[model samples]
Target: MHWQGCDVAFLTQHGKQHLVGPPIEAALGCRILHTEGYDTDKLGTFTHELARPGSQMDAAREKARIGMALTGSSIGIASEGSFGPDPVGGFVPWNTEVLLWIDQKQDLEITGWAHGHAQSLQKPIQSLQELELFALEAKFPEHRLTMRPSHEDHPAIIKGIHNVPSLMEAFERCRSQSNNGLVYVENDLRAFCNPTRQNIIRNAASDLIQKLQSLCPACDAPGFWVDRRIPGLRCRVCGRKTRLPISEVWHCQICKMQEERAIHTKALADPARCDHCNP
Candidate 1:
């Protein structure tokens, strides 16, 4: 059951197919079959208690295998998201999106990356008077809220509210349950709950299209993309080796062919990037 030309399986508990499925279909002539009731949560979950089983690549490939097993489809797709401190700077929040494409027929796999600042879509209100301002900021009812006691006496004292009356009720209820009598309200980050995250998904879908379209020079396999870089570029000023990429290593999954190509850029690394010079 191919849509454009290729048959692929889409494994998701969330309705992510609405965002990621189309790009593969359009770019690579693929059809996507949804794998329902596949307990991807068993592999890992967002909650702190359920630690993810492996590195990003391993998890993604496992998800693809699960999809393929469910539908007996040769091609599969999956997406993963990790939200935490910025890799570049530890302070700011960073939301990283990863998309994985697998072609069992060709034994090829490709991944796409996207991330940016998340607006959070949340703000707190301590008083009834602040409701107007909070509503204006959050666009309440359109974007719902989760309210809980700032300090919990009972772990079950949490509420998800949409309407103004319910919001006020939940806030007061949570405050009453807290020893400090304060409530914290924030946006729910579930895909359906957060529009910002959905936008990131769309952007990652686009990136996947580009990755699937790319072909390996050696094996002519789809998803031939850069895996990593060989560092030790020379400093422009000192001629000393610096910590910058000198060549890019591209690989083909099906043929296990790897090629290292010199970087196109001629600009040498600055002294600041040199460990000996800078340190």
Candidate 2:
């Protein structure tokens, strides 16, 4: 309580602290306080019930503020994640996990994120064989499943399908309840349920740790780091610019100071990536 940034209030309903807290605690040497009073689902839910407003970072900030207010801690932490199809061409889905840190006394807000392939699989099931296939691909048992009568807006829904027999029962019951004789089975995206997402959150926490380790040279405030990347890497062959970062702009978190540093003077953009050469 004496140190302004030593205690962090973590806001989570689905056990995110367990996944992300260890790395942060190790990196910052701070006590992690999990807030139990806040309704995290009220902000938004994976089931699509309460539509989340604002950008992911905005939601994360709100969550952190709520936790700090409830716990009377100057430091607050929260995470927001989104799952969907891979931006690059791929059959499997992807997850973007973002971890946010807010230090009120230091006036610092830092975000770290990890994005890549995700194991969040979901599909409409009609047959036992199909269900088994889906489960196999989704890493069943390791990753829990959820069932609903339909994709959305169905009263009869079975959640937290962990075991084989329970999954079997839920599939049959939900399929029968569906108007189309089909059940929507999705990988439980909750942090407690999905190990893949848990790992992603851990990665994001590591990113935050790296960013927080840096202090502003001018003001000595934490979270002083790269603010922007300048892209104008010139091709070696024709000397035309390509959309690759040539310099990084560093800024102070507390003091209004900025410095731009050029990267790797010896390196040049390959002709393959140059728009004029490739196009």
Candidate 3:
């Protein structure tokens, strides 16, 4: 009955385990039971119809819980993603992905993540010209998009648009539903639709593999890793404390054991990162 003897449960209905599951299996050297049939959109959706409740991490945890409940497995895994303007490139897209691992008997919960560049697009349109622009900008036909009248909850919302004919048809239909004649178009941020997001999910899986394989120095638990950061590296020029990580605090998810070690090769922060030195 215990899932410990068996493989881990990875909850996904979107055929995502194929893209993100390889690292986990390769690292853990266990079978991955891909559990499905859960309507995770009820927890939250990127298209924003039902408005995902709580944090992104909460949604992922719930998914893992559901997978474990459905399959009677003690170990479960799940992932979630968020998209927005790129932090480094200004208007370009960025994805924040999280992969979570849960074990009931061991009472262990750990998260691995990736927060960086992604190919995502969103636009609000009033005309055919604008839609075409959005399509090109989003790298459409490849990435695809979803269309809705006023909101994601719009009854006439069209999703999974792949071709120009379908795009034109959906736009005309959705435009009619809107009072202002504008349709909201966004890259379908779902795993099944977007490769960029899937790539990020894979990176998150890799991150989890690192944590899962890492044994705690104290108790030899698998989930021992950096739990937090200690900021305030001294500025090289000004010698004032700068907001850069000076150390990594490693902790065990199960034992709650904590350890802190210096993260940087040098003790001082770069002048560019120092507020007083640069600003």
Candidate 3 displacement at residue 150 in angstroms: 4.8
Ranking by TM-score: 2, 3, 1
Indicate the worst ten consecutive residues by lDDT in candidate 2: 1-10
lDDT tens readout by residue for model 2, 1-279:
123248899999888988878777777778899997889888887776677887788889999999999999988999999988888786668899999999888778888889978878779878899999999998999999888886655656677799999998998788778888878988888888898988898899888888888877887777778899999999988998899889999998788789898987658888998999988
Residue-wise C-alpha lDDT for candidate 1, range 130-241, written one tens digit per residue: 7667666665666666666654223543434668788778877876776664566665555555577788988888888777777777767677778899997998778888
Q: In angstroms, how far off is 201's CA in candidate 2?
A: 0.4
TM-scores for all predictions: 0.80, 0.94, 0.89
Give candidate 2's error at residue 128 in angstroms: 1.0
> For model 1, what is the error of residue 97's alpha carbon versus the real structure, in angstroms, after optimal superposition?
1.2
The alpha-carbon deviation from the true structure for residue 255 of candidate 2, after best TM-score superposition, in angstroms, is 0.4
Model 1 off-target regions past 4 Å? 1-4, 39-59, 120-144, 150-166
lDDT of 3: 0.82
Q: What is the per-residue lDDT of model 3 for residues 34-152, given as tens digits with 9 covering 90 to 100?
A: 88767877887777667878888888899999988888878888888888787876786789999999988888888889887776776778988888888988889888789989665
Q: How close is candidate 2 to the true structure, as a TM-score?
A: 0.94
Best by TM-score: 2
